[model samples]
Target: MLARGQNVPTIEQAADFVERRRPEVATLLISRSVLLGSADNFLKSFPGGTLYAVKANPHPEVLACLGASEIAGFDVASIEEAESVRTVCSSKPLHYSHPVKATASIRDAYKIGIRHYVVDSEVELDKILACVSRPLSIAVRLKTPEKSGTYDFNTKFGLHPAESVPLIKRIIDAKVEWGLTFHVGSQCKHPKAFSAAIHVCHSVIENLGKMPGYLNVGGGFPVAYGQERSDLTAYFVEIKAACSRMPRVPLLCEPGRALVAESGTLVVQVIGRADDRVFLSDGVFGSFGEVNYSKIQMTPYHLTRASAVPSLAESEFRVFGPTCDSFDELDQRLLLPATIKEGDWLIFPMMGAYSNALASRFNGFRLPSVELID
Candidate 1:
């Protein structure tokens, strides 16, 4: 029988066990512990509202959990994502939150009953008006200044606050349904960034002299990659403070990585060991670059038998993937238990979010199969 308790085997032991049992599991475990924890945190922190960003990880299981929790909605970029959410959850509101606008995509999203969307410019507003025939609600993405040490969303989308207020005015003037939304960017470590943006939202609302409909704070919740993460409560406090000033407008948050990143793990077997490095069966092109792009750190563990305790002492080792490209290096200097050896298994945590959604099968690498664990 498989290990049935909470005390599971280390990566090295798991690899040895798999060698005897299910050798085909190239990437085996994606634990629910991290996922549930992250999702629960988001729900608890943002009592105002929460919308799981579908771009993070579109796994049906993840979506099911959010739906069960009565999450506000989904932040989707494409019609396929909209359909995925529809398949998993009942008729919940869907936000076509991608800042950019394509006519065909707009038509499809409108067809699928996506009333909420993000518009940063008048041109996108025009495209949406042309494509969407029915009375639809929209969100104007406000381009706020990027705080220090965070990814900037202003470059791609969102209008200047001054311009946004007028744009909201124009939408109202045109008798079009619309709301106000702002994204501070992704992997935001600063809680004040949201507070600052919320203050801006207040100004915009006051300037518009109407509540509009919804005030989307946009998703920038950070996940613990390598370093210690900030408290979600602090960020929520800022949001609450801002929202309290304008209580009538509904609040929405689009959290992608924080919802599913920690919930999943990537398990790979060591296929080759030579020199000071060990090459795994999976590569960065396979399912690890999501965190890498954000420069997030990862923890690797060795799994083995119950009696065979993998040494906890750490040593520097270059862990590479099966890809031939030089950039395929997963970790330049990963410190793992000294007992890690050939044919061992390595497990990476906080991989449930962006990895699978953004993974590319480059160099003919096969995507890892996902296994959900309770």
Candidate 2:
């Protein structure tokens, strides 16, 4: 990985370069080793074709690193996402996994070679039928009992198991290939969530009196943050065990956060400190949106003083963004050294997921400059 202009071959060098420059904007540090390793882990262990969820982090470098691995396709929520993935990894299959889609996106996705689509209702199936003349594959998305996950994904999407049975029949009757899929939720903490969700899908299929061509256990894979640790393999084991009770079919998984979260870091400078609040260059609408949107707890930001002596007196303080808006602040408090001054750098690791994808260019604070490190 390479930093902007200082030939930073290591994270150490990158930190030193940033300290010397004292730039007003924030920096996103990308570790190619970590990114590639995460992709390799999913490709080697997941036991089936894996699709990188494009909405997680679609940066060119991020996509390029994963593209070089064994990932087979991309889980795209929109035609625009498919187009972005196409620009970098053009040959890979595209799965339009968003249960609901615009008819125009359906026709365009077909023209762009996306053969796999997911639907949660009959209206979506009709939309797909109206747009595509060629053979297509549909995956019926069933809403599973969500007991884990940081985000409430089911609030806006997902279909009830009872509702999915009729939808599955509609797809089969339409003469198109079909499958079953579910999302346990994002950043899921419970291992049993996958198994429970799979059970819901199976029961729906049993009601329909048939099994699908494939079973897509949707992406909600978790990542460790701060002191929280999880046995990721246990999730796969539980999912496999649960599937044993259902008719055998080709299995697939889509992992977003677990695949890329630990691969990047956000480097921000403390612009100011007022009482117990510390203001940073990037805030809720910037690279730190995950902290605001999902209440994701970050590992305490690491202080890098470079050649200077570190402070001994540390305390917890509220962290705020550089934006003028009052709502542009982190939901949690951060503990840092009392000596942390305006020019000091605070590094936030595990920031690759949803950071780039959700950042807004509001208030003229564009997304941080991404610097890749080897």
Candidate 3:
């Protein structure tokens, strides 16, 4: 997320601002209505309580919209994130979902009324026990082999089933509110992956001879960004059925990308054009960081122009960001107008997830100006 204060620019009134400005940049079009609509959808259909994953898009405007929609909670990865969520909604619960946390983070989170945490190892449990005196609720992060997502987060977090068994036992021994949580992956393509992970959770509980307090089907819910996915209604239906197979327990989910990806769009101007290549004002180091795929990954994009005479001719070209490093280029080609030129804007849709949140100030170019649409 960018700073709390920024100069909001209009895509129509100041469309040529990039050409006139000294340092070129992209523009983010965030729809407050779309964001709230997504949250409302989840609240209506999700089988259990919903928690917005703060890491996906931590923009204050987005959080405020979700808060207004009455989201059940927030899945924060860090203490700082917990504090950020509090700015919008102080009464809702905060789930510190990151498995590995600094000791200081635990202390501060405890001070801030965070009672739920995710841990995969014994050491982290020990740290939580030492820092927090109040009774705590914990969800064991279970690593899953079902790989159906665009991004694989299992390599970094979560624990294998065999590994989770001992940890679950330890949690039971400690006598705190305990549960099982698993992330099939980010932008998971199929709902079956979630069902499979839940079966694993059920098996673990069966073997342990104890039912957990809840089961968190962590955020891997898919959003339309160019790839085919089960309809949101049907996806939730499938997930709800899967959870039914598990032992009777309260269900919770932390959705980041699926909740916010469609809520925003990226409007990037063509800095200049070479033969079959276009240089954008922003690059991977900026708002396009999570677009680690070639060919913009199926999310829709369109050109904003004064004249429609050039027609909507499609041409694939290599795209580059504003950064100086050669490695800052996008993973694949982008299909835009062959007549695309400087001052012409290209708007990338479904860009809310992992876009601005992962941006950096490398080469003196930070995230682009964002306009929140009411």
Best by TM-score: 2
Superior by TM-score: candidate 2 or candidate 3: 2
- Per-residue error for 161 in candidate 2, Å, reads 2.1
Give me the runs in candidate 2 sitting further than 4 Å from their true place: 1-14, 17-21, 228-230, 301-309
lDDT string for model 3 (24-117, tens) is 4576768776778777887788888999999999988888788777778999999888998899888889999999999999999999999999
Which is the winner by lDDT between candidate 1 and candidate 2?
2
**What stretches of model 3 exceed 4 Å from their correct place?**
1-24, 227-230, 293-305, 308-310
lDDT of 2 by residue, 1-374 (tens): 11122112334644665666765778777888878877887677676789899899988888878877888888999888888888888878999999889988988999999999998777888899999975889998877796588776788777888877778787888888999888888888888998898888778877878878999998888876654433489887888799888888898888988888877777888888888988989889888877766777765444544543345678888888899998998888877887677767776667788887788888988778887767
Per-prediction TM-score, please? 0.89, 0.92, 0.89
| lDDT of each residue in 186-206, candidate 1, tens digit only | 888788888788778788877
* lDDT score at residue 25, model 2, on the 0-100 scale: 77
Compute the lDDT of residue 250 as modeled in candidate 3. 89
RMSD of 1: 3.9
